[model samples]
Target: MTLTQDAAAAEAAAHPRRESVYRPGHPVDIRRTVGMLRRGPGDPTMVFDGAVIWRTVRTSRGAATLALRAVGDEIRASAWGAGADEALETVPALCGAHDDPSGFDPSHHPLIAEVARRSPGIRLARTNEVFDALACAILEQKVTGLEAFRAWRLLVTKFGHRAPGPTPRPMYAAPTASEWHRIPSWDWHRAGVQPPQSKTIVRTAARADSLARAFRAATTGDDRDRVLTSLPGIGVWTSAETRLRALGDPDAVSVGDYHLAHEVGHALTGHRTDDDGMLELLAPWAGHRQRVIRLIFASGVSEPRRGPRLTPADHRRH
Candidate 1:
């Protein structure tokens, strides 16, 4: 009943074919697929360290489970699922799977290069699961992260199925679109969701199937943005965030974040910047804005200002 055991069972059921491409004991890390099921606070998920081995991917085609272990200098991959072989073949594309240093030429930008060199573990976080990402984004609308996380935990526990695998920690499966729609208003209140956010979730859920199709069909930048923004409550920022994870976009700038401008400013110029300042600072790397931001984040240059932390407000107690 452990995550690893559950994963082993799922792998066995799927009958994965193995191939080696990475060396065992080498540094390997797979970004957890956002919204994939995991046990609660008490449980843990088992992941490979040293060498990048074993990743669970949910894609447009279906769930694509992969296991990678190190062998000499090469990394081997064992993948299985509805489209196992194709998914495995597409792993590199899905995972930015080319040589690590190919597109990210650090030499062009001294700051980026230094950051990348220093923190090589900051690979892009991919969720391959569009609906889950969208749902989570919806939950986060106009609320503190604590509120969102609390609601997410409650909703998932109430409606999400247990993730299949032997994960070391407990995690909840993100609720499916239909399941999200089925959540009663009272439950939303209990989960600490305000009426507005709750309505957005319901609205999105009703059109989930259509949105999923549109997301898959969207190939051009304009087309993708248009399709995502067509939904209620899915504006520029929300759509951008969802597309960033769902499509693994490298340049999606989070424009409306409360902290990003300050973080970017602190990292770039030792002062907090507004959205305009943040955009101006990032203009040099337009195509790779998010990547640069990631590097700045990895660099760990931002320090806390001498001020009180944002106080948490409990609407339930209000």
Candidate 2:
């Protein structure tokens, strides 16, 4: 089957593209902010080239290609495709304009305080697109970053709609929920996605519409987590990830992450800890736990690996 580049090209030709200039009061590092959305160095949905970023989104309106660049204190944004207008409208939030750090006092911990002082440009970005964030999170479940990123690259390149713009490189928007559901089992295998992860994606995609609405309507991060984890395959880690990415929930701490607890513990107390210990350690930050965790990651402090890196499982071989 041919790629959907033709359809997006035709649609772009028929519509007037949208553009906006967003002036975030603070020094906004566009790459550091939106780079959270990128799955890997070779992610098909996001490209960071120098000071500019090109991203393709499967928006509620439709597929869109957004180009964002930081100029002086203003962020210049341009969007192409049916969803261009919507994408342009959300540029400010996407650049972390809505992330308020007023209540986040870094004085609770010396390490956190130092990191916060040094990394003033770090802000939690919100996509406001639930399914895309959820799907990406699900793909990462129980897998190494290498495996997850490769699966994302292969799947999006093969099944996703071609991005509608002059991207730095060929890019594509993540497939819609229905399209994700329709991706064949063999295709998932070929992409190195395990059966469990692939099944979870398909099952979630089947109810993406209602789930998206539920997640959007939920007022608190806990409520959203309840709605997300109610699904059979989704758990605390996936829910927290989705909330962080989709809603920019400041307090969403990934409880079940394999290395997060150890990393947080090492960064905070100079040793390793379990998930429970991590929770207790992060409890001081409570409402801003994820922000603290982000600081820890940005601080370049991680637990030394006791052994060799875990070899990524190649499910295709099985």
Candidate 3:
């Protein structure tokens, strides 16, 4: 490397870590915001210390790790690594600081109203990390949570970098899109990522930079969702899932989710419902549909499991 570039990098690295503080208008639940980022118990990119939540994210500039905590009105954050500034800037969004729920006047439904009352701090978080959101959603496509999370843990542990922070636990950043594209087929097979999902990841990675242009061009959350859906293998469920995290579109609903419809149906109408029924049921909530879904999850009522669970097809055992 040129001496000038080397000096620049050293200077950048020498820059002290940044800290940010924000005051949301309403109560902000740190745990719920962390839950939005967590994939499973063993997610290598996310860790919860007793007081603070640490997250390692792969940003456009580079990888970054942030220690985040919220108490009362103030949200506190400190970040490290190349993308530290970017991460610190986005901390408020990650904590749902910009989420406005005043317009979501609840219907007269007893359960929805009650759940809303019970959970004042529940807000949908937006990370604005599109590639990571899309990749994770693709990982979760058509699989049990166990299978998807295992695959995610395996891939990230193997290919991702150690988080750059003084985190209490070892955390890793999700791999860059280019790194994901370079992973061999055998590695994916070993990670329990089947062909369909793996192919989608590779294709998306190839066009990941181009997809960012669409996001930049989008003026509304709906437009951003459509831009994501334009990619092959990115359907309604995946797009909704990605937007819920990447854009925090309150209206985004995972329409084709295997269990979401049933749970929503049971909660709303006292019976199980399909995708169409769930959409119809959620129509009234329009702009705040995902917020309503979050409330339902907060309500602690889900449809009873009746069918056989999806068994993991461990290709490594083949």
lDDT to native, each model: 0.64, 0.89, 0.84
lDDT of 1 by residue, 1-318 (tens): 999678767766875454435332323234432212222232112234345434444444454456555454444666655545654664444344422333556555576778777656454545466787787777777777767777777887677654333333343345678889999988888888888778988988888888878986887555767887887677767776777766666677878887889998887778999988988988876667777787786676885876986665666654
Candidate closer to the true structure by TM-score (higher is better), 1 or 3: 3
Model 3: per-residue Cα lDDT over 159-210, one tens digit each: 9987776768778998988999999999999888888999999999999888
Candidate 2 lDDT over 1-318, as tens digits, reads 245767656776876678899988897777778888899999999999887899997777777899999899899999988789888988988999889887898999999999899998888899888998999999999899999999999999999988777788999998988999999999999999888999999999999999999999998888998999999999989999999999888899988898999999999999999999999999888788889988998899888889998998777999
Against the true structure, candidate 1 reaches a TM-score of 0.75
Clashing pairs in 3: none
Query: What is the Cα-based lDDT of residue 181 in candidate 2?
Result: 99
Model 2: residues >4 Å from true position, as ranges? Answer: 1-17
Please identify model 1 stretches exceeding 4 Å from their true place. 1-94, 98-109, 120-122, 220-222
Candidate 1, lDDT over the whole model: 0.64
Q: Tell me how far the alpha carbon of residue 244 in candidate 2 is from the true structure, in angstroms, after superposition.
A: 0.6
Best-fitting candidate, scored by lDDT: 2
